[model samples]
Structure formats: C-alpha cells, structure tokens
Target: MAKQERAVRTRRLILEAAGAVFDEFGYESTTIAQILARAGVTKGALYFHFASKEELARGVLDQALTLEGILPQESRLQEWVDVGMVLAHRLPAEPLLSASVRLSADRKARDLFGTSWPAWIDFIAGQLAEAKAQGEVLPHVDPGATATLFVGAWTGVEILATAHDESGALEKRIALLYDTFLPGIAVPGALRNLDTSPDRGARVWKLHQAQHHARQEEAAAATA
Candidate 1:
C-alpha cells in the first residue's frame, strides 16, 4: 500500500512538472530532460509512468474536463454553472489544468496531442441535455449549440484574463458570464434558484474537500 501511494505521488509530481514545463515552453520545445529536472525524478521513473512526451501530454489533457469541485445540485444547470465557476477558481492555482489549456491553444501541441476542447464541449452538451430534460432549460435551447458557444466564450474569457494577469478577478468574470448566459437559456424558475456568485466556486471546493476527507476517514475507520 505504501509503495502504491508513493508511485501515485511520484506520478503526480512528474505530471505537475511536465505541465509547468509545457505551459512555459510549447510541447515541441519541451524535452524529457527538462521534465526530469523539474520533476526531480530519474529518467527511468518518468519512463515507467509515461512512455513519451506525447503520452505525458495526453495524460495531462485527460484531466481537462474534470468534475472534482462540483457537487450534485438540485438543478443540472446549476451543476453546469458550477463546472465553469470551479474552473475559474482553480485554474490559476492548478498547474495541470492551466497547462492543458495552454496546450490546447498551442497549434503545434494541439495537432500532435489533439485538443481537449471537443471532449469539454461534449461534456457540457451532456450536462445541458440533462438540464433540458429536467425543464431547467427553455424548450428552444439546443444543448450542442449552447455547449459549443459556452466553451468558446469561456476560452476567450480565460485568454483575456490571463493576458491581463487578472487571475484574481476570474471568478467574478466567470460568474458574470453565467449570469448573462443563463437567462437566455434557463427557465425562469430554474434561473431564480441558480447561484452564480463569485465566491460559490470556493465554497463548493471547500465542501468537496471536507466530504472527501470524511469519506477517507470513514474508510480508514471501517478497515480498523
């Protein structure tokens, strides 16, 4: 069990190191040696986890559409909003996610590893579909179209925020995005119930961490 945990931690360290490198230098310019240096792991250990830089990049990209901070909500639309809010809250602090965005935006990296945009779009569409079925969305709202637009808009907002070095204000910007957007697609009743506050993402993430620790404690107790 200790060995497994160590391996997991090592892998996480390598990924984070790779993400920081990839973010600073595009995938084409980044090398294994740089990753090894950043990760402080031997070359063999890095290879054991990832066969090549491409595979490592793909691994990072796979984390792009995460549900980590989002908890189940009464309305799926609210859940969808939480996804964007949590990302806005966490992306600045999370190297892997920020690097994933960088890679997706980098033409060379995107061509080699493919972008996570499509998967994100699909995930959003799925969420919107559920919301529509639950009558949270208006009848005329098209899930796929809405999802595509949201992803594009979110990407633009992220770029602008990063360019301006306004990481601190990103949550407010994202909340405003949902505030302006939800009214167009969401049913009146559902819209009223939705919370798009700037601090919501932080609150949700804190709750998620508390729940996760509780679950871990329960598991440990059960084993004892």
Candidate 2:
C-alpha cells in the first residue's frame, strides 16, 4: 500500500513538473531533462510512469477535464456555469490547466497528442441536454451545437484574457459570457436562478476545498 501511494505521488509530481515546463516552454522545446529537474525524480522513475515526453504531455492534457472544484447544483445549467467559472478561477494558479491550453494551442503538439477539448465539449453537452430535458433550456436550443459554440467562446475568452494579463479577468470574462449566453438558451426561470457572478467560482472553490479536507480527515480517522 505504501509503495502504491508513493508511486501515485511520484506520478503526480512528474505530471505537474511536466505541466509547468510545458506551460513555460511549448511542447516542442520541453525536454525530459528539464522535467526530471523540475520533478526532482530520476530518469528511470519518469520512464517507469511515462514512456516518453509525448506521454507526459498527454497525461497533463488528460487533467484538463478535471471537475474537482465544481459542486452539484439544483440546476444542471448552473453546474455547467460552474464548470467554466471554476476553470477560470483555477486556471491561472494551475499549471495543469494552463499547460493543457498551451499544448492544445500548438498545432504540432495537438496533432501528435489529441486535445481534451472534445471531452470537455461532450461533458458540457451532456449537461445542457440534461438541462433541456428538465425544461431549463428553451425548446429550440440544440445542446450539442450550443456546447460546441460555448466551448469555442470560452476558448476565445481564455486566450484574450491571457493576452490582457490582468488578474481576475478570465473569471469576469467567463461570468459575463455566461450572463450573456445563458439568457438565449435558458428558460426565464432557469436564467433567473443561475449564478453568473464572477466571484461564484471563488466561492464554489472554497466550498470544494472545505469538503475535500473534511473527506481526508474522515479517511484518516477511519484508518486510525
């Protein structure tokens, strides 16, 4: 059990180190040596988990769909909003998320290792579809199409916000986007109930952290 836990930690360390390096330097410029230096792991250890640099890149990208900071809401549309908001709140501080975007933005890297955008799109579409089924969305709304465009719009906001390089800009932009876009697809009742505030993400993140810590404590007590 100890060995398994150690391996998991080491793998996570390697992935995080790789994400930071890839975020700073594009995938093409990143080297195994750099990743090892950042991770403080031996070459053999990295190779044990990842056969090659490409594998590391893919591993980082795989984390792109992480829904760690999102909490379930009464409305699935609100959950969808939370997804974007939480990502916006966390992306600046998270190398995994930032690195995923950087890698996806690179055409060569995207071709070599497929982007996680499709998975994210599918997840959002599932949310919208469920919302529609629950009568949260308008009858004319197409969940798949809305999801694709929303993803595109979110990507654009990410890029623009990163370019502006202002703190809290991404969150604000995403919140504004939800505010503007949701009204079109969501029914009046659902739209009124949605929380599109820029700070909604921060609040949700804090709640998630508190719950996660509580879970860890409960697990420790159980083992004790």
Candidate 3:
C-alpha cells in the first residue's frame, strides 16, 4: 500500500511538472527528457507509467478533467449556468487545465480529437441540455451548438490570455462572456436588469498584488 501511494505521488508530480513545462515551452518544443528532469524522475520511471509523450499528454488531460470532477445533477437552468461560470473561472487558475487549453490548438492535439474533443464536447453539451430543460435558455436554443461555441470561446480566451501574459484577465473575460451569452438565452421575464461591470481591472490588479504578497509570506515562512 505504501509503495502504491508513493507511486501515485510520483505520477502526480510528473504530470504537474510536465504540465508546467508544456505551458511554458508548448507541446512541440517540449520533450520527455525535459519532463523527466523537471520531475526528478528517471527515464525508466516515466516509461513505466507512459509509453510516449502523447500518452503523458493524455494523462495530463485526464488529471485536469479529474480535477473538474462531475458537475452536480441540477434540475434548474440557472443552476447549470452558475456551475458553468464557476468552471470558466476556475480553469484559468488551474495549471493542468490551462496547459490542455494551450494544447487544444496544436495540430497534433487536434489530430487526436478522437481521444479528446468528444468527451469535452459531451460534457459541455450535457450542461447546456440541462440548462435548456430547466428553462434557463430560450426554447429555440440548440444545446449542442451552444455547447460547442462555449468550449471554443473558452479555448480562444485561454490562448489569447496566455499569449498576452494576462492571467488576471480571465475573470473579467468570463464575466463578459456570461453577460454576452445570458441575455440571448434567458427566458423572457426570467431575466432581471443588473450591472455586470465591477471595475474588474482594478479588482484583478488588487488580487494579483494579494497573491504576490501571500507568496512572499509563504517563502518567508518556509525560510524561518
């Protein structure tokens, strides 16, 4: 049992290290040797767990999706919308998820659509269908189409934010996406007027500062 636990930990470490490397250098530029070195694991260890870089990439995706877990079984459309919003906001803050989004645009990754896109699309479609059935969306809204659009928009946003080194921009973008999409889907008379803007840039700035300070404090704590 202890050996199994250690093995699991080692696997997680490798995945996390690979995810960070992939995010920094991209899929094509990254090699298994770099991942192995970063994880402080032997090549043999890496090979034992994954047959190739492609398999490791799939493992990273699995870990990321596992982190998201199953969405709650909700009967309300509004509830599903809220859940989707949470997912959008959380993905940016997660390293493995961000890596997956980055890789989604790679030709090699797209070629592996048989392994990746279906599950992702189905997950989004399920959420959209739930929302539609709960009357959170317009009767005319196509759940599958909306789901595809949502995921596509998410991937695009992640790519743009990464290219600009604007991690803090994710929250505002998510809010904007929701604001833009919600009105069209909202049932008549079910929607209420509300201000969506909240000085997001300033809030993001403050949050970044807070994170920096927290990290500094943690470093100090570790050294002391």
Candidate 4:
C-alpha cells in the first residue's frame, strides 16, 4: 500500500512538472528530459508509469481537468460560472491549468476532449435545462446552444486575460459580462433583486490592486 501511494505521488509530481513545462514552452518545444529534471524522477520510473511522451501529455491534461473540476456532472450553471471565474483568477497561480488551456487550443488535443469535453458540456447543458425547467431561465432559451456559447465566451475571455497578464482587467470584464448577459436570459423577477452591488466590484478591484503590488514587490526583491 505504501509503495502504491508513493508511486501515485511520484506520478502526480511528474504530471505537474510536465504541465508547467508544457505551459511555459508549449507542446512542440517541451521535452521529456525537462519534465524529468523538474520532477526529479528517473527515466525508468517515468517510462514505467507512461508508455510514451504522448501518454504523459494526456495524463498531464487529465490531471489538470481533475484539479480544475472541469468535468460536468451534477453542478449548477451558477456553480459552473463561479468555478470558471475562480479558475480564471487562479490561472496565473496554476501552471498546469495554463498548459491545459494552451494544449486545448491545439488540433491534436481534440482527442483529449473525447474524454473530458463531452462530460463538461453535458453537465453545463443539464444545468441550463434544469434552470429553464425551474423557470429560472427564460423559456425560449436553448440550453445546449447557451451552454456552448457560455463556455466559448468564458474561455475566450480567460485566454485573453491570461495573455495580457492583467487580472484586474479580467475581473472587470467578467463582471461586466455577468451584469449585461445574465439579466437578458434570466426569467423575469428571477434575478431582479440580484445585488448587482458596486461594493462587490470595488472589493474585486482592490484585490487586483493588491495582487499587482505584490507582483511588483516580488520583482523588485528578485532584482535586489
């Protein structure tokens, strides 16, 4: 049991290290040697766990999805939105998720979707359907299409925000999107009393400012 646990831990380390390297250098440029060095594991051990680099890459992607909770299941639409927002905010702190997003943009990574994407989309669609049935969403809304659009919009915004390395801007964009988009689709009175509070927005802005300041301080310290 101890040996199995150790093996699992080692595999997780390799997956995380590989994901970071892949995020930093992309799939074509990343090498197994770099992953092994980062993980501090031997080639034999890596090979024992994964047959090839492709398999390892897939494992890295799978681990990322698991960590991010991207698979669709019994979660609600609001929960999905919240999870996506949290993931976006944490992307800067999570190299594995960043790498997963990068790989997801690749044509070859389509195969991974066979395992991850359907479950996630179906989950989102199910949530939307439930919302409609409960009269929380507008009766005319198409659940599947709305689910697809929501995922696309969120992913696009997240990618752009991450690319600019601007968490503050990202938060603002998301807030704007939620305020403008949700009301249009929500059932009458369902979200009428929603807080839509500026105070919340202000708090998010302040948090971003703090993060920005911390980054600058870290950079200065590195130079000092």
Candidate topping TM-score:
1
How far is 100's C-alpha from truth in model 2 (Å)? 1.1
Off by over 4 Å in 2: none
What would the per-residue lDDT of candidate 3 be over residues 151-210, giving only the tens digit for each residue?
777667656766676655765676677678778866755456322342433433455567
lDDT of 1: 0.92
Q: What is the C-alpha lDDT profile of model 1 across 42-88, one tens digit per residue?
A: 99999999999999999889887787878998899989999999999
- Tens digits of per-residue lDDT, candidate 4, 27-131, equal 777889998999899999988898877887788667555323333333244544554555555556667776777677656555544334555567678777887
**Who is ahead in lDDT, 2 or 3?**
2
- Judge candidate 3 against the unseen true structure and give its global Cα lDDT, from 0 to 1: 0.67
Model with the higher TM-score, candidate 3 or 4: 3
lDDT order, best first, reads 2, 1, 4, 3
**Tens-digit lDDT track of model 2 for 1-224:** 69999999999999999999998888899999999999999999999999999999989998888888889899999999999999999999988898898888888899999888899899999999999999999999999999999988998899889888999999999999998998799999888888899999999999999999999999999999
Alpha carbon lDDT of each predicted model: 0.92, 0.93, 0.67, 0.67
lDDT of 4 at 157: 79
lDDT score of residue 188 within candidate 3: 57
Candidate 1 wrongly placed segments (more than 4 Å): none
lDDT comparing candidate 4 with the true structure: 0.67
